[model samples]
Target: MYQNYNNNQLCLSIPLEINISSNHVAVAISHFVDSIPDKLIYEKAMTSGRPAYNPAMLLKVILFAYTRQNFSGRKIEAMAQENIPTKWLIGDPDTVPSYRTINRFRSSDQMKRLVEAMFLSFRQLLKAQGLIDDSALFIDGTKLLADANKYTFVWRKASERFEGQLDKKIAGLYQELVQNKVDLAMSDEAPKTDSKTLEKTSEQLTNEIERLDQVIATEPIIPGGSPNKRLRRKFKHDRHLIDSDYLPRKRKYESNNAIFGDRNSFLRLIRMQLLCA
Candidate 1:
């Protein structure tokens, strides 16, 4: 059995705007968001799914959150539930969106243009009302705290520097891995030592070491001592190379690859491109 509950059942309510001051930035944000051309927002609306939250409401809530220095989607979700001005902008408690939905809306191509347009008009409005001094210096240092896998950004030059260093290290390791005369054919292929190539090379070294172990198992021990010191030393050396050097470099390259995936930027022009591509 469940208790009778209804989201829409109204008992007693007052106008949400009454709780917010008219001069509040949220009030201004609401007006600016409403003034955004409907066609611009409507064109991006999804045609199939549950009804979408109004784009104006999302913009107003986001802009309001910005004024409060809250850039995270999860924080905005909580704000919608707890903040009076935010609640007023959303207009209905039932329509409060999840962090995922809020982030998707915030990061969309359409949202990018809309935010720029809104701020441009907003700045003009402020200037006309003598609310802003154009001569004053402004620095936008707002840090984004969103889904890191999807939205975290880093500079391209920094990524390139790191990549170049990794490539040099890989080249050096490859030369060491194939330095022996038996494996000299691999030296020609060393220049192609990308992550996958290194991984394949590691597997080859493992197989060669295993084969050597089998040969040592069959080889006669010298009278009373170690089985063929020559093969034993060779096995130990190859094992150390893979365990201490090659494997670690391979894993580092793979981990850095994942962290730096698709998020690099050019710091000066600030274009978005893949870090690894």
Candidate 2:
């Protein structure tokens, strides 16, 4: 998802005569944009302080950038400024948002809604064009490498940290008990325990228990969420063995191997039949 480039590199520019077509992603996004209910999403923006770019154009540019895996607002802005296809798609070669604004917009709920709407529209269009055969479907999954190392796997760390925290809590409780004993020894009267202090300490212990419970419940024994939920649930049922026997050993080898398998790769392969009318 990240690319490295040397800015100091210079090359001789040569003009070659070759036919190049418009970007397919851009075209598809443009069609989706055109089909959006603009009045619903754009009406509010039109009355704002200064408005120039339409929702369709902005949505198209954002989607195009996303398809290219250029999710960063700064990268998108750079592409808009320098890339011909991006510029053409936006219909504004001159208009480019600052990285800050673009980032804010990208993170907004409105963008999510727009993307969902666009996807639905695109799916409907494809269906109308007889591009989907709903009779048969294939599903599969592959592992995706997290942006972290094997050492970063926190399950073991969490356990160690939890043990240390529990030790500290016990030590604190011991100190409180010692203090109570000292107070009782110094005075003939029975040492009075502060009810509020006891309640607060109890609450802290309860909170720690809740925290541990959450961590245990949500541990990555299996991935959970939409497309992968079924697979994840099945794996969860077998998690104890998977984690103890497979994951640890496999992760150990994988961490040392330079050539991580397709599981670590981002590439996806999907093939479906298009039934044309």
Q: Considering every candidate listed, which one attains the maximal TM-score? A: 2
Q: Which stretches of candidate 2 lie over 4 Å from their true place?
A: 1-23, 46-48, 137-277
Q: Estimated TM-score per prediction? A: 0.41, 0.42
> Number of the top candidate by lDDT?
1
Give lDDT tens digits, candidate 2, residues 7-50. 88897856443222654667767776787777545746556677
lDDT values of the candidates? Answer: 0.70, 0.57
State residue 237's C-alpha deviation in candidate 2, in Å. 16
Worst 10 residues of 2 by lDDT: 182-191
RMSD of 1: 19.1
